[model samples]
Target: MSRSGGRWADETIHRIMSMTKPVTGVALMMLHEEGRWRLDDPVARHIPQFADLAVATADGGRAPLARPMLMRDLVTSTAGFSMIVPLHIPLTGLVRSVPVAELYRTLDLQGGSLSRMVERLASAPLAYQPGTDFEYGVTHDLQGHLIEVLSGQTLDDFFAERIFRPLGMADTGFELDAAQRARLSTVYAWGPDGLAPSPPSVTTTDGSRGSYPSAGGGLYSTLDDYLKFARMLADGGRAGGQRLLSPASVRLMTSSLLPAGVRQHFGQRLDGLGYGVGVGVVEDPARATAMDAGYGRGTYYWTGWLGSWWWNDPASDLTVIGVTQQEGAAMAHVGLPQPGADLRALSAALVYGALMQP
Candidate 1:
């Protein structure tokens, strides 16, 4: 899409950050279509390490989990996980020593692998019981691990062969070669001083070749490349004359699955919002009156920490993607209104508004 300042060509690659969750979520659903696993299955079934987990009580003690974390909980963000470091908990020392915490401080941490990340996550207590609340954490990262287990392929290989290659999303993946890196936009953080170049230590953009192929928030892609993925969803899972996912799977991915109580929290983020598989869906039109941006229901979208956003509204056959490398933009929304300052809402307004032409 074009902006006032200059052109954002189809070849420009940007850090998609958390936008990777939906992509990973789609991959998992593909496996589901093959009967490899069910959404309600306990995550421990695939990663036995989570067989016996704990819950972090506010009283400064640990308690046995009320129930196992279901696989659906991971995608829906109802698995009682939070991105917070939880340094005050009983295992502060242990948690700090784990490499996962290093990722919080900076993405430059080396030698840390996704396996150890899962092991560390298992050791930590859940913020709440599975399916009880909405908390975002390393849920999708665990999904990535499960994908590896079931597909017998690294996350990168799985994406390359299954999703990226099939959709012809040539510019989307974890690793970027030198040529790809050259086109990557610089990440900036809005701080006390002003908008300045974010520290290079933020992440290893060299590629997803690192040990941590963070399924939740790690991927790079160009505008046109990601548009293909989004439009595929908008077209009921078909793009380039190929069906990447069945219509039923696409419906399941975009439909509202949030618990009643959690629905309120989702609403708080965006009026009438509901948690779908890996993105937010507009569930209550009345409640969503403020932020619909002329888009109708059945609109599913998600963004990244570095201020990138993408959404597909099947009702209108429209897809919009905005990518910019701006950290600390929407610190409150966890980068939802990517590049901060309400750009996501504005983009929707402009796109849908223009389409209203006679």
Candidate 2:
């Protein structure tokens, strides 16, 4: 995983990894705006390959799904998709090995085309009954395939036409051009020995193309470009005099959608937080273990694998972006926080703590 060498600047491009999820969510919601699907619609309705979806049992057996995997489950990350990956994340169950997840790894399901990925995903059993638990996994990749299905365009094309183009995010795309490649920063990882530069596992191909337009964790962007996006959702989905989603859609995206039993999986760093369509919602500051958690309710945020982060405070119309070319979620042998733990809570405390006094 080697990255091109460059010094970061205001225009320096980054592989803003998991942050791409919310953008994919926006694309799907746009299709929803077009009346293409319903929240409760069975995922099988669109992808019949999941018609016979199954769940895994502790005793090494498969059971029928408790209910159909719903579209909302995909958005909220409770869709029961397996979360196993080669690298380690700090969350529980995310790196756990199970038969279904093992299937995912053995097949290298993420390394292929979206259509093939979905077909393989449908063949594996879910980690739990749909909506019963939350494990950040391959569900959003399914959303990428869903977008392709409903929009009749490739994921990259759809993003450009409906999102990046509409918002004038000229610097965001799944692939980098020759100029962009030169501007991309060399990524680093924090180790017990201290910070060290490392080659990224992903990069632009053929100077302007990428192998995977993965909805789950793939996109290159700049802070200036993504701020335009975050502000749009914060301002009720309107940017540059065009509305990509209605106010209602924005609410659904920012409001906490995680259920009581499931949110605990977010673990301690994100205590009192809830998930809303690929972002984390601040539902209860009091419940947060961090002393500095001061975000207003409905402030939703997300971070990237390489420490790229953003949050939108709709209350005050404030949006913040932070970028570090370091691995936010290290391989976990040294037990670093996933997505730069304490980065958001501490930042919110300082920023909001000042505003309240003034």
Candidate 3:
């Protein structure tokens, strides 16, 4: 598939999925730099809809939260919002399949605004309270909504100005145009049943088209375009001599943000690995499991659901992206062998191998 004017031919368009989180994170950082919002600021400060939130309990009960959710909590996945709930067992399997419009309708029926979603989330209780544990879910999507509220621009527009346009990532967006759509790779899934095609679906509020521009998992991009964005992060948030983020912000975004115990749990195999704002940071190679084979420390990266991956290894001054659209059992079994050849690992291996060649 062509990528932003055919910069890279072998590489194709990637169904970015959750990797969209990092892109959204960058946009939030830009807004923070502009003084539009602060990390500690209450989300309700700008989006008043979130003033009173609640948490869910283990017994399926709910209670009011001691405080409103802070912006940092949403960025860090500590907000306790989940796309799945144990009580809603029947809906678990259909979480992804449920149209975004339907999801919103359910939320609306429950009298849940984005803010109320947080409140109800808090009252329902969390696997862990805000800032207590590391979990990944729809926090970034809330961040996207926060961006909409603060910037008065849609998440798509915010990303276009702060990230895509600056990094020359022309082929990155929540939706593709007709010509680009023709090049979209087919999504595939492997299960106990067998291999099957996984067609793309619109997952936005209203559902007609993706009006909600999900920051959590709503983007399609090509390898070359994504590479530019990765390269900018690798280059300390500057690309083409344009400073998109201050060096300090880049450092902050790529540095360890979690507590020591949380970092250890996530990076147990990697002696010096941790999660930064939106990327995984490798601090020590010796502790990393088999995944650290040829990788260096201080590597920052993230991946998409359909096996797409990208990394910025400051240690090597390199950035790489691998694109594909396969998930589930295919990923567990034939997707990539032994050291696991998923896009993230393969991309890292390719770059590391090339570095060792000379």
Candidate 4:
């Protein structure tokens, strides 16, 4: 018996959707360690295409940007990139409209490479002024492009040679081989009666590599493989006997990257947590909701669009990762309640109850 009938074997590979964001953050942090760029640097300084980004006005018109987007904005997901909040709260008052989100889908940027995505995205106005608000759109995918530009390699190549290979996450990547594809778990949606197989996702990977590697939500990883990555974060960015990032950098990545006056709520009473580089930082644990679920105040974590979850707690020195392979709420732009959202709260309660210590 398992959460999804026959559950994923320990070695089974599953697509770890937005969970990919933190990995992208780690990759960018690697560049940060090399001093490739600074946090306050204007994103246009690196990705020149975004230099003239416009802001979409409510009346269907465009306006000049009030301020330039920064590297910090990208890291914090406040770059005004028309966040994709599906059943997601705490969005930009500007670009978080149904039309803009639909606009992102209309562009079908996922079908093309990040470079092309950049060219087209630059033509459209941002949902809001950079750094003014938080919207969780293509910031990580943009980070993927930034990684490619800084490292002068394709996103896949850089991830392979740097993070995955170094961490011994052999089976994880944007694309899967035939054997790995065989193990890719099927996603399900809860229907009226019970669980039903989900329709094929456009973001679903084929057996071959893709030109448009989604840094935000495109990576197939096994439980063991993702755990290796999580353990590395818990170990201060060291694994496989290699030092990937400094403890200071890890702190920066996990600390609250949001500017003041930005809402941190994610619906479902998740207001206590704050957004970090590519994950959620457990800030102000005194507040209730998912913010306090990590069992420690400084714990940092994130999850996938489908059904994978993970958290790294510095206080307790613990890392928890689980996959359920359910994909419904994310695909439903209507913001349907995530069928499994409550399970996380329950699971966390049970896990912390057993811990018996902070």
Candidate 5:
């Protein structure tokens, strides 16, 4: 068994993968609080490149989109864009090799910008449409791009000033400096092949090579720093006596925004699982049978592409962060013990064990 020897107070940096989504979500909400945008506004209003997007139909053909994508759609993964297609195929890699500045130069949606990526995606068939079904993909990455265009600040800068700086999340951001990199935990994945280190490309965000800071997946943080952010969420967006977001905004971000029957569209029966703006909402704790968390309503959480996971349980005024690194879909099918599930179980056990001690 691989063990992380650090505690929540340790200043070790971790590669946070998709857990970056919640931070990006908070950034958008901060913009919302400032009246920079609204949930219902068409994304095209700011991102003109999406003005001519189309939706892919069942026959593998494209048609004009029925309506413009709303800002909220981007947050909820209902924007008709996806990172993967059926049979586990990736759709586009346009942004994979391009520099960040060059990526934003194209307006035809045929290039690598988030708007362009969505435009190309519009040409591909959607698993579902706007506000119809929930799919996890690059929506939050697009949100990060929107933050850049709308706020006129790079995603990293905006997050640092508005979210990280205020919340005392000192060890969280897109890239790590030398000091932080020295403390970064190595990422590992267990495949049928054997236990191996995750690729430096997959694990490190040193950014010495000028890689585009992917707001969606590009971030490194420490457990304690992240716990600060999570605790702020548990405290309704206040940290260190500073109001990072309004209580209403925090509530709105965590509220279930999916329409009825949307969960079924994913083809998985997540009995009590619902999606909030950017995090997973635990609606029925019992249905999370595969996880070790105490079943409860209103438990909001998310996980990283690596094995990291965190959740905020308001009922207990408690939050937990479990850090590790293992990658691939369906941890059970990956021929190794599922690190995420184990971490969740460990967290739950710790919480319960602490309670029993009292």
Candidate 6:
């Protein structure tokens, strides 16, 4: 089903993009279970640079935070910082008339080490007061850096020693060797004409060259490799008879954690789903069924930038993971229709229909 020229295989590696957020979430919660830090702990406790943050005003002024940003705020995306603004609402008029591609380029060029980037984030004016609303940005990346700070290990190393090794996920990681590079799918993007190959810098995973590990959206994985991770979550954090996370942790990670005020804003982005620790949880089946016929109230899923997607639906005892090289996976990118929005919905509909065909 992948847009890559060859038939999709379980071994093919593709940049899973934001799908990495859930993995980062699991990693942080693992530390949480270890008592390394509490969810409500102020982020300044570990990263002192964020102690005093200013909120950005529409009038081009700055305001103080009503409250400190909490670790849990990052987990639920209520941190008041985001990588993007709505297209119509210009970012201080800086990007009002800029093309999406140019905006992306500006972000790409601002890169530095993860910690350095976080420092830059701390200095920037937040869109709103922390813990007051939902604003999805690089919160997980901050969590990832927090993992390194608290665990005293690189994010990739922490994942390796803990989750991947125990679950038998050999093909998942930030960097890939020659053999893995060979299995990577050819990335394609939709242009005015049709689908065409995308540039390597946009699609390929070059861990050795990137400024920092993008705990937010940087891992490369295969369909089978990610499914193993999904299955672990669905199995109440157990895999192959080993418990990677406590059932309570899994439950908290999968359930909605948004405050009432934030819930409305989150709903605007994802109509029937609620924001969990890292993944999106199905809350209203009747509304979600409009997106995907297979989506049930408890189905949990997330998508990558390049279109790879996975979901664990308890209703049907279904765990589905798909890999594709389409440029706008999840329809998060520009130049596509609303139905072209997240191919995950389409894939789920088709898969569910097949399941019903006795």
Candidate 4 regions off by >4 Å?
A: 1-7, 84-95, 201-203, 206-211, 265-270, 292-294, 328-335, 339-341
Q: Write down the lDDT that model 5 would get.
A: 0.66
For candidate 1, which ten residues in a row score worst on lDDT?
88-97
Clashing residue pairs in all predictions, respectively, total 3, 3, 23, 1, 1, 1
The Cα local distance difference test for each model comes to 0.72, 0.74, 0.61, 0.76, 0.66, 0.73
Task: Give the alpha carbon lDDT tens digit for every residue of 235-331 in model 4.
Answer: 8888868988988998999988888877443332245677888988787677735444546887787877676678888888888887777763332
Regions more than 4 Å wrong, model 2: 1-7, 87-97, 200-210, 264-270, 289-291, 329-342
Q: Candidate 4: deviation at residue 32, Å?
A: 0.7
lDDT per residue (tens digit) for residues 1-358 in model 1: 2212235666877888789999998898889899998878988888998888887666757788787788878778787765533333232322312333443434322247777777766766666677887666567787888899999999999999989998889989888887776677777776567777776566446554566787887788888888888888887788877898999999998988877766524212445778787888887655673455665777788877677888777767777888777763423343222333766666767887788641
Greater TM-score among 3 and 6 belongs to: 6
Summarize candidate 2's per-residue lDDT along 275-324 as a digit string, tens digits: 88788777776774342346666678777766677878766667878877
TM-score of each: 0.85, 0.89, 0.77, 0.89, 0.81, 0.87
Which window of ten consecutive residues has the lowest lDDT sum in model 3? 200-209
Candidate 6 deviation (Cα RMSD): 4.1
Indicate the residue-level lDDT of 209 in model 4: 54
Regions of candidate 6 where Cα sits further than 4 Å from its true position: 1-7, 84-110, 204-209, 264-268, 289-292, 332-342, 356-358
Tell me how far the alpha carbon of residue 115 in candidate 3 is from the true structure, in angstroms, after superposition: 8.2
Candidate with more favorable, higher lDDT: 4 or 6: 4
Q: What is the descending TM-score order?
A: 4, 2, 6, 1, 5, 3
Task: Enumerate residue pairs that collide in model 6.
Answer: 307-329
- Give residue 196's lDDT in candidate 5 (0 to 100): 80
Give the alpha carbon lDDT tens digit for every residue of 3-51 in model 5: 2445433776767777888888888888889999998899889887677
Give the CA lDDT, 0 to 100, for residue 105 in model 3: 39
lDDT score, candidate 4, position 356? 68
